[model samples]
Target: MKIIYRNNDRYAIKKLLLDIGEPELERECWRRKLHKPRRINLFFLETNEGITSLKYKYPQKGVETIIDVSQYDLPECGWIRYKIPY
Candidate 1:
């Protein structure tokens, strides 16, 4: 999911947890360093060939950012890039 934050191009990569749901809240996170939380509603892209064995744990600290989908520990076959603000 390409997010447009401050009109900058940044990317994040993570494994897809579940199939994209209907128009709903996208992944979100909070940063204590900045003192505020960030939320975004990303569109649902198709679920293509993904890493079956490779798994990813969700962020607990609440750090939301654009995802690059290719940086997962498993070299699965999913790709996503999101635009975000720091």
Candidate 2:
């Protein structure tokens, strides 16, 4: 699917999930390095072709990241929200 981050004009996702070493608490030093402040704020343009969901699985860490990008249906709002670690 075609995904574009509204904040930037790029047509693809960028700088997401740099390292999945171990689970770290929110606001922790390790976590900060994993997901930077700018990377976490994802707002996609509201379109039919927008992303519906995003899933990432790390077997070693036994961590599964699942984010439903379509739940917050803001009709005509012109944006689809998808935050990291959701």
Candidate 3:
């Protein structure tokens, strides 16, 4: 899948996972890192078929990450709405 993060640039999900680990691991890391004023927010964009997008919104910017699900399999955890606490 294609992820649009930070400056709305597109990135491959496989590459991102390679850099950051799995989704669960990434969420755990993010939860630990978000002990300050700044934070990142995650959201699952829902659609009739299933989750069509995954968004990560940063403090200063809008969505820092966006995963397009149309062409990829959903994560093993399944599609659930998430907003990682800061």
C-alpha TM-scores of all predictions: 0.18, 0.22, 0.30
Local accuracy by lDDT, each model = 0.28, 0.33, 0.40
For model 2, how many clashes? 0
Kindly give the stretch of ten consecutive residues in candidate 2 with the minimal lDDT sum.
13-22
Error of 1 at 47 (Å): 18
Cα lDDT tens digits, model 1, 4-73, are: 2221111221123332221211332122122222222222222223412211222464333323333333
* Cα lDDT of model 3 by residue, 1-86, tens digit: 33322222233434333444467545654665532223222433333334455455555655433444444543443333334343
TM-score of candidate 3 to 2 decimals:
0.30
For residue 62, model 2's alpha carbon misses the true position, in angstroms, by: 5.9
Model 2: lDDT equals 0.33
TM accuracy, model 2: 0.22
Highest lDDT: give the candidate number: 3
Over 1-86, each residue of candidate 2 has an lDDT whose tens digit, in order, gives 33433322223323222232123223343432433223333422223355543333233432233443454432343344444341
Once fitted onto the true fold, the runs of candidate 3 whose alpha carbons sit more than 4 angstroms away are 1-16, 19-51, 76-78, 81-86
- Model 3 poorest ten-residue lDDT run: 1-10
Q: 1 or 2, which is superior by lDDT?
A: 2
lDDT accuracy of residue 51 in candidate 2: 52
